[model samples]
Target: MILTVISAWRSLLAVAGLSLTVEGLYYLIRYLKRFRERRPPQVLFFPAPVTCVRPLLLSSPGHCNCSRSHRESALSCLTRLLLSARRSLDVCVFTISSVELSSSVLAVHGRGVRVRVITDSDYMALAGSQVGAFRRAGIEVRHDQDANYMHHKFAVIDGLILITGSLNWSAQGIFGNKENVIIIKSTDVVKEFIEEFERLWNEYDPSNYSFSPKS
Candidate 1:
C-alpha cells in the first residue's frame, strides 16, 4: 500500500509539469501570431521598374562644408542646398552681407544656373555690389524692402527643394547665434515656397525700387 501511494504521487507530479509546459507554449504561440500579423507586408515587387522609386537622397546641415563661424549649421545646409540646385535658384531674404554665401549664389550663376534674388530695401544699398555681380552673371536680383517690412528667409532650388527659416543670409545669422530653419525636400513643399517667392517678387515694382548709398 505504501509503494502504491508513492507511485501515485509521482504520476500526479508528472501530469502537473506537463500541463504547465503546454500552457506556456500556447501563450507563446499566440503572442508570436499576434506580432506577425501586426508586421508590415514585405514588398517584393517594384512599383516603377525598381529604378524610378530610387532611394531618396538626403543630406543634413552637418554633412556639407560650411564656414566654421556659424553655430546654427545654416551655412552647411545652405551649401548642400546650393550644390543640389539645378535649372533655377530663388532666394528671398531680408538682409544680405555674407561674402561666402553670396559667392555660392554667384558660383551657381556662373554654371548657367538661373538665379533670382528678392531682397529687402534696407540693405539694397549695401548689396548693390553683390547685386551687380549677379546681374553681370545674367542673374536677376530684385528687392521689396518697402512692402510691409519684408522679413522672410526662403530659398527654392530647382523647383524641388525648399529651405525656409529665421536665419537670414547675413554673416551674423548664418555664423553667429542660434537660429531656426527648415529644409524641405518634398515637391509639394517646394512648389508652395516657389509660389510665395514669386508672389512677393511680383508685388513690388523694381523700377521704383531704389536705395541710396550710406552718407
Candidate 2:
C-alpha cells in the first residue's frame, strides 16, 4: 500500500513538471515572436478638437435580431448630445418621436438655448410624431412636405459641434433599425448642415404661419 502511494506521488510530480515546462516554452516563444515582429503605435495625436463620442451601431432586423438594449443605446447617444447644448441647436432629421429625446430637447430649450427643427412633412401627422410637442413649447419646427424626400439626420450644437448619423429619432430607428451616428467638432461641417437646414426651413415656411419665441 505504501509503495502504491509513493508511486502515485511520483506520477503527480511528473505531470506537474511537464506542465511547467510547457508553460515556460509557450511564454518564451511568445516573447521571441513579439520581439521579432514589434510594430509602431497606431494612434495619432491631434492638436485640434477632433474627438469621438459613444458610437452605437445596432444590427438590422434581417442581419440580426434587434433588442431593446440596442434601441436604448442609440437613443441615449442622441440624448447625450442634445443635453450638452448651451447657445443654440439646429436639428434636421427625417422624423423624431422618442419621448426621451423630445424631453431632452425641451429641457435644453427651457434653459434658454435656441432650438430649430426641420423634419419630413408627412411624419407631422404620423401617430408617433412629436411635432405637436415642439410646436406647443414654442420651438421653431417645420416640415418639408413639398420635397420628394427630406432624408437627413443631423444636429448642430451651438454652431460648433455636429452630430450626424443614420439613426432616426423614432422607436424603430433607435432600437430596431441598424444605424450609425457621427458627432464631429468642426465649424465647416456644422456650417454645411446649417445651410441644409436653412434651405429646407425656407421652402417649408408658410407666410401665414407664425411660431412665436417662448423666451
Candidate 3:
C-alpha cells in the first residue's frame, strides 16, 4: 500500500511534467510561425507605399525635422545606412564641396557601387576639377541645366534609402548651417526621383561638356 500509492503519485507527476514540456514547445512553435507569417516581405520597387505611409505616420509629429544636434545624429545614421548599401548611389545635390562627404561617396564607389550625381551646371563647372576624381573612381556625373535653381538635395541609395534635406554636401552645411535632413526609407519616393532624373538625363547630352575628364 502506502509505498505503492507513493510510486503511483511520483509516476503521475513525471507524466504531467513531460506533457507540459511538450505542450510548451508546441505553443512556442506556433507563436513563431505566426510571427514569421505576419512579417512584411522586403520591397525592391521604388516608392513602396507601405514603407512611405508608415514613416509618414510616425514622422507626422515633427515631419522628420530635428534640431542641430539631432540633425548631426541623423546625418551620422544616414552615413552609416549609405555605407551599408551595396548596389547603387544616386545623388541630386545643389551644392557639394565637403571633402569628408566626397570621401564617403568615393568609398562607396570603390566598393563597386554605381554612383550617379546630378547637380546644377554652374555648380558642376565650379567643381570641375574635383568632378574628374569622382569620374576616374567610376562614378558618373550629370549636370542639370533645366531647373532655374537646381535646388534639390537628395541621395537615393540602393533604391531603398533616400536622404533629403537642407543639408548640402558642404562643410558649412554639415557643421555650421542649421540643416534638417530626413533619412526616408521609402522606395516610392526614390523611384519617382529616379524617373524624374532619367527624364533630365535624356535631355542633357554629356558630349557638350568640356569640363569633365570623361568628356
TM-score per model over all chains: 0.59, 0.61, 0.59
Quick one: best lDDT, which candidate?
Answer: 2
Residues 69-133 of candidate 3 have per-residue lDDT tens digits of 23224335545566666898887787677664576677778778888787776676674235667
Clashes of 3: 5
lDDT tens digits, residue span 35-72, model 1: 65444321111111111100112222233243333333
| Best TM-score among the predictions, by candidate number | 2
Ranking by lDDT: 2, 1, 3
The residue pairs in collision within model 1 are 70-175, 121-145
Could you give candidate 2's per-residue lDDT for residues 81-141 as a string of tens digits? 7888999988888888966677778877887899998888777679888989999999998
Report, for every candidate in turn, its global Cα lDDT versus the true structure.
0.66, 0.71, 0.65
The CA lDDT at 192 in model 2 is 83
Runs in model 3 lying further than 4 Å from the true structure: 1-72, 127-129, 207-215
Error of 1 at 161 (Å): 0.4
